[model samples]
Target: MLCVLSLAPFSSPSQSRSRSRSQSRSPFLPNVRCLFGNGKQLQEKRRRHSKADAISTQEVLDLFDQLSTAQNPPPSIYQFNQLFAALVRTRTATDNPVFSLFSRLIQAEGISPNDYTYKIMMDCCARTNQVGLLFGFLGRFLKEGCKTNVVVFSSILKSLCWENRIDEAAIIVLDKMPKMGYAPNVVSYNILIDALCRKGEIEKAMDFLHDMMSKGQEPDVVTYNILIRGLCHNGEIEKAMDYLHDMMSKGREPDVVTYNTLINGLCKNGQIDKAVDCLHDMISKGFEPNIVTYNTLTDGLCKNGEIEIAMDFLHNMVSKGHKPDVVTYNTLIGGLCKKGEIEKAVDFLHDMMSKGREPDVVTYNTLIDGLCKKGEIEKAVDFLHDMTSKGRKPDVVTYSTLIDGLCKKGETEKAVGFLDDMMFNGHKPDVVTYSTLIDGLCKKGETEKAVDFLRIMLGKGLTPNLVTYNSVIHGLSKLGHWKEAFNVFRELVERGFLADDYSYGAFLGSLCKQGQSKVVNKLLDLMIKRGLKPSIFSHTS
Candidate 1:
């Protein structure tokens, strides 16, 4: 028989002993009964339950198995609940093992779950993104005569929002919730609003906010923050500001998150001056600017070709006791590289290291790419070696940058060598790498080798994009390989890639150069039929 023990009403050791002494003195007393058999046995059961609760799920399951077959009485519902809670808590994958456990608890163990059990199971369903399982559990809960409450529906709504099923979640919140006698709370509305904003549905989110207010629900700071962020993301900065003012007017002050959202939006939209002004306003409002605010402003200045000003901002940020992180250094390095200022970028790299901030792969890649762009391939190669020596493995971007640089400098053979090295290092060369080498070989008058590379690319199950095909076709046409070029052109058309002006121009030019008047006239007719006028170069050829 299962020796079920109630989980509550555990007495302290001193109290148990005191009660034991009193019971021993008056065994005939009306209210002097031991509900737990004895004080010692009660403490033992409490100890066992505590151990079960503290151990891992697997260990608890093993203990349960031992209790089921041992000479001692079987474990209680409290122990089973502890095991179920452990299982729900420790689960990491998408699969819902709790459902199966629940069935075992009913059919095999003959144990009924309490409210805590149902709540934890619902939490598990939501955390694991098992929406279907959550609904199934809800049905079973109602069928078992369990009273429905806000927490249950809230868990379901949270799961729906997590899965991005906002429309269905909205229906449940605005319609089904009230019908079921459970009014949707501010938290429920906030979940739906955040989900809508994430999907770029700013207008729908606003309507929901207004609906919430019409229902006499005062929007909290969280509510205003969501609207501000959504508006900022959608580039509706003016509206976001209006709401910020409205939020303050409603006696709800904007938080750091609200100001940061506005600053990020302004920076992204290229209104750096306004972002700076907003930053000052934030300071005046007694909100300390965080690292994110500085990073956004610094990045915006760099992107707008105001690197010197951006550097000044970086100095000011350091003066404010804000440390420059990897992101800050990387952004500055990339900006300098973009302006062909590799030396200054390198100086910042040194500065970053001196400031006790380690340079990441992005920092190295940006520097390498800059050096390559400036025709400093040797220096780039040296940086590559330095990266490897420092135990930082170069990724595909690193190899591709080096290969492209070599190709541009007419070192196609070395580029191919780098490709082989990249593969040997377990980094697969992507389309850009292949296309760079192909274009390099084509420009070097090695069309046949380029064709071989294309064949290898196809063999690897990588479909050549338009740029690849265009490069090959142009190469073959320049070499007077009219038939092969035409075959490639026909393949391009058959593959459903639109033949642009460059495509038509190359094909027509080759045919014209060969003096193939009949074929040329037919090609011209097809181009005209397709509403493509021949380029001046194609006509001259």
Candidate 2:
């Protein structure tokens, strides 16, 4: 669909000629596409004709031949620019024939490239990863005395940024093209700051911020948001908060995004009280809570074990004329499910349906998980049926949850059956899916089968994690396969796995049961030397 939408303009000479004649015509035929996702059958029909995604190289060359070799006056440079722009929008496709046509047209009768033409070429160069060509084009753009604008400077900075050569971009903006009499503006600084922040170079981004201020270009809301988000994302919540105060001191009032970033950060850092206070502060400043604000706050409360408060927050959102969205409902449902309030969570599901809020995979997964945890496996399976009937295909997590529940119920065979069912439905088992089965089989004393499955997991190129490895070790050691246990343990050490409490406990428990007290003591000494003190549970194991 994306490919067709992009290539419709330059697919044929007739279409290109028609476009040349009537520049105002939109490429999308309204008769063919009235509204996106409206006519599903028609959309599929159009998608099947995806061969039209790329314009034939011969067809484009023929169009150029007609333009360059014809007796008629050539198309206006503006028309040529339009063609280049359209071709660039198609992801620089068509074997990148635009550049050849552009170069050949530059030598044609009465045709001259305009500033827009140069800009289009710059965009093409950026898209094609031809940075050296981009600089060459930039020099020509200046040598030809084409008018320089913010877009041209931005093109260079953005092109360099795209190639991840930020230092060069930064220096070029200050060092290159001084004759053009241009300096980096606030937008330019913001672009660099944003790039730095996204790369988690927060210190460098801050340095850019200081440089921007020192150069008399003030940081705007975008500048502050980028830095704050970077700080928060890197778990520097304290630094993010300091910036929040700093932004206010500099008279850059917080926006919804600012509040949401801080709130999410505080929630993640387990500072729920601060997150709540941030909400109050936002509201007191006359900022009406949007869906994102309410949803973030609700999720924060739920994660902090304040499900009742999240419930109240939902009512508050509705009372304030903000309808609870699917996300809002899902968060509350998840919180209720976590509290073992399955009945209330189901009530929310009904309420959500009544309110015309469709339940997505997450909504159903939460309910299914809640049912599984409550040992109502039948109801959970019913939820699976309800999900498929409603046209939402179950994801890996959904089937894995079912497998986990069945295993917990000691029905390992039934759990194993789900692997076949999942694969038959075109969902290959992921690491978690296979790990769950391996753990279940091990717990069921099916060590040989579990070991075989582990081999299969590796055959499929899946790296077994600590849980998978520990599960195998526990199963083998429990059944007195100490030799195999030691082999597996050696492989784990070779793979650089530090022995966790579970790993130590598995060996200690098995040896203790076999009355190998001296071996257990030596292992304990090694564990203590590695700073892993055994817990009561570890000894019990």
Candidate 3:
């Protein structure tokens, strides 16, 4: 989560009361303490403890217990607020425990929940995705006559939006909030707009934007950024750019986030050069591109087969005092591997380690996959050992890549050994692993063994996907098992998989080879009825 800058520190009940009293005092004695008795001391204590380092949830509970047993009969709200803040910062599960703590605070300590208390509870609801609990809390808040400020309402709207309950959020923003004497602010508008855009309802999002403008609410940088990102996500880059122009015309300068969104969209849409132009434009606009900006451009260039240019951008990033992170190195390594530059990719890996940027599992997986595809299976196997020895465990992808390479090299028995090794290492073979091995066995004229593996996959409760079924059908057809092939094809259709051209061709060819002309004609008619066109290969067979 990105941290927003705030002029005031986190407010507690005591601090708020002190602030209210201070506001009425004369300007000449700004530091004069209007707070009396224990309240002033409690506020000072909270100020001192609030700046403490993050503490665990258990520590928070312990502190609460200590305060409860203290010479003071009831603990200050500021102390509870500090504990709550610490609990939130520690990323502890704050739902039930927080509710229990609040119950104790209200029932036993007789402490009234303040605005900051409600805000913290709402935040907990949002972070834990307990929007249902938010409604319960709101009812209690209203019953207690707690003011529903914009911040609290925004938190509720944000939680609803996060859960994709945009309709409920919209009702709150458009109707319920106004009825409660709270107008939807720019933050509330942005939350709903972002949600709508994420759900691909760009038109509805635009309607809300226009409605906001009509109500005399100026769209801020966040509002424009959300719309641009949504437009880019929906592949409407041209429209996104138009919105960018509109944003600038409305006197809202595009920020780095705006340009980064455009750059990512352009790259995904295969407009790398245009993305580069956007980067340059951002630099000229006095926006120092952050790591995200540089990483986005590097990935775009790498994906477009512009590896050399991507590397140059990396150098530029370093010269500009931006250290390349793991993501930056991974993108470049993946590009190098894709271009069959395995050696160069390895060199980059070493460079990354020398620079104190350790290669992760993704880094090793990319290089291993590249080596396997390049038919250097031995080197790939060695690299897998090196990865494990360096405390980087090989995932399914790493093992699967090596198994596939071994199978493709006609080393089916060796691939089977690796499969056992994979299982021993606590990695279960997925559909891809089984399909690869099945195909390799069939290609080696071991259809019986392939069928056995198929049964084993089913026994393991793995549903065979399209690729798996297609490979089996092709294998059985090649081995002159037309009846078995036809049965598998029928099962494929029954399972809701569309029989593609390869499927039809395989069955048609097998029937044609067996002189089953009647069966072939019926199959052809069925293919046409299913809206699958039999290719020339099917007819020629």
Per-model lDDT? 0.80, 0.80, 0.81
Instruction: For candidate 1, write residues 56-93 as lDDT tens digits.
Output: 44333333343333334545566556546655655656
* TM-score against truth, every candidate: 0.80, 0.76, 0.87
The 10-residue segment of model 1 with minimum total lDDT is 27-36
**Clash number for candidate 3:** 0
A best-first ranking of the candidates according to their lDDT comes to 3, 1, 2
User: Candidate 2 at residue 269, lDDT?
Assistant: 83
Candidate 3 lDDT over 167-190, as tens digits, reads 989998899888989888899899
Which regions of candidate 2 are displaced past 4 Å?
Answer: 1-113, 117-149, 159-164, 177-180, 234-251, 508-541
**Candidate 1 or 3, higher lDDT?**
3
Q: Candidate 3 regions off by >4 Å?
A: 1-54, 72-74, 89-97, 539-541
Task: Give the residue spans of candidate 1 off by over 4 A.
Answer: 1-113, 143-145
Candidate 3's TM-score reads 0.87
lDDT of prediction 1:
0.80
- Root-mean-square deviation of every model: 10.4, 7.8, 8.7
Clashes of each: 0, 0, 0
